[model samples]
Target chain A: GIQVEQSPPDLILQEGANSTLRCNFSDSVNNLQWFHQNPWGQLINLFYIPSGTKQNGRLSATTVATERYSLLYISSSQTTDSGVYFCAVASVYGGATNKLIFGTGTLLAVQP
Target chain B: EAGVTQFPSHSVIEKGQTVTLRCDPISGHDNLYWYRRVMGKEIKFLLHFVKESKQDESGMPNNRFLAERTGGTYSTLKVQPAELEDSGVYFCASSQDRVGYSYEQYFGPGTRLTVT
Candidate 1:
């Protein structure tokens, strides 16, 4: 089984601050995704970067598959961003189903 | 387009009782998946359904959990005689089956299950 570890288990920041979250996996992966579990418990897809870099507005993510790690950056974070951020990956050995294995997640709290 | 949607946003039942949760994936999606977060732990995969067939259920905890996707449109997960340890948030996700391309999975608001 592959292991996914997230850094800074808990984080707190002022609104408009910036932060970066890291995710490290134990093995090679064919799919890597960043998700935001909002206060309502809705898992919103942030990015699906199996490799390379991608950005959406104030959020960006970069994945170095060869290094088995990924980084997610939030710039000028807002109170609405206060929630759990998760990094999930599907191992190459997962076959065509691509069932995701999730990390414990980074709990982010943005105070206004 | 509508994203993944789950029924009975929350469920509370006594131990040994039966509970069934439903998930309706986005239109035109062929891949449906079930995952849960138990005791505030990491969300774990339960199973994957490709259309009407069970593609993989290796992650299922035990025989107490049964999942079905009849006609390949909507799916249901039934927990028979649920145990206290079954309390958690169950999430459903869906994505298109792209052969050579990797597609992002969209998740529904999870169902919070509490078994006393």
Candidate 2:
């Protein structure tokens, strides 16, 4: 099984600040996604980047598959962005179902 | 379009009792999965169902946890004689295609289970 690890276990920033979260996997993966678990316990899918880069709204993500790492960038962070950010990925050589392996989440707290 | 949905948003039960959690995937989705996050721990995979068959359940923790997907539609996870360590958030997710390339795996809010 592939191991996923997230860095900057905890983060705090002003509402307007920007931050980057990192995820490193033990092996090559075919699909990678970022999720924000709000205070209400909802897992909001942020981005799905197996490789390359993608952007949505004030958030962006980049995955270097060859290097076995991914990054999530949050710009103009809001207080509502306070939550746990998780990275999940499915290994390229996994079973037919491609079940995701989640990482130790990065807890982000944006203050006003 | 509706995303994955889970029932009984929260449940509290005695250690010796049994509780069942249910998940309904987005219509037409063939890949359903279950994952759990215990206190102070990373979320871990439990199992996956492709239609009515169990595609992969290698991540299931132990025999006390049983999961099923009937008619390849809604799925259920039952924990009998739950233990204190079983208390955590259980998440269910679904994707249209997992065996091929890659697609989004929409997740439900999750069910908070507390074993007293």
Candidate 3:
């Protein structure tokens, strides 16, 4: 099984600030995603970037498959962004079902 | 339209009791998966279903936990004689495709299970 590691175990940012989170995988993966666990405990899919780059609203993500790492950027952070950010990836060896392996996650706090 | 939907947003039961959780994937989505996150731990995969078949259940913890998908639409996870360790949040997700190249998984809000 491949291991996923997320950095900046904790973060505190002011509203309107920006932050970046990183995820490093032990091996190559077929699927990578970033999720925001909100105060209500809902896991909102932020990005599904196996490789290349993608953006939605003020959030962006880039996965460099060759480097076995992915980065998530949150710009103009909002108070609602306060919660845990998790990075999960599916090992290529896991077959086609796309079962995910999650990282420890980064807890983010956006202060008003 | 509808994303993955899970039943019983929260459940609390005594040890040795049985509980069943249900997940209904988006219409026409062929890939469905189950995952769990224990207290203070990262989410872990439980199993995966491709339509009506159990594609991969390698992540399942033990025989006490059973999952089934009938008619390739809705799925259920049954935990019998539940233990204290069974307390956690179970999440269900579904994707547009089973395999090939599409790998996005849309997750449900999750069902929080607490075995007392």
Best by lDDT: 1
Give each prediction's root-mean-square deviation over alpha carbons: 1.2, 1.3, 1.4
Clashing pairs in 1: none
**Model 3 chain B — which ten-residue stretch has the worst lDDT?**
B95-104
In candidate 1, how many Å is residue B63 off? 1.3
Positional deviation of residue B56's Cα in model 3 after best superposition, in angstroms: 1.3
lDDT of 3 at B104: 88
Give me the displacement of residue B47 in model 3, in angstroms.
0.6
| Cα-based lDDT at residue A61, candidate 2 | 97
Model 2 CA deviation exceeding 4 Å by range: B98-101
Model 3 segments more than 4 A misplaced: B98-101
Winner of 1 and 3 under lDDT: 1
Which TM-score value belongs to model 1?
A: 0.96
Candidate 2 chain B: 10-residue stretch with minimal lDDT: B96-105
lDDT of 2: 0.92
**Docking quality category of candidate 2 according to DockQ thresholds:** high
lDDT for each residue of candidate 3 in B30-52, tens digit (9 for 90 to 100):
88999999886999999999999
- The better candidate by TM-score, 1 or 3, is 1
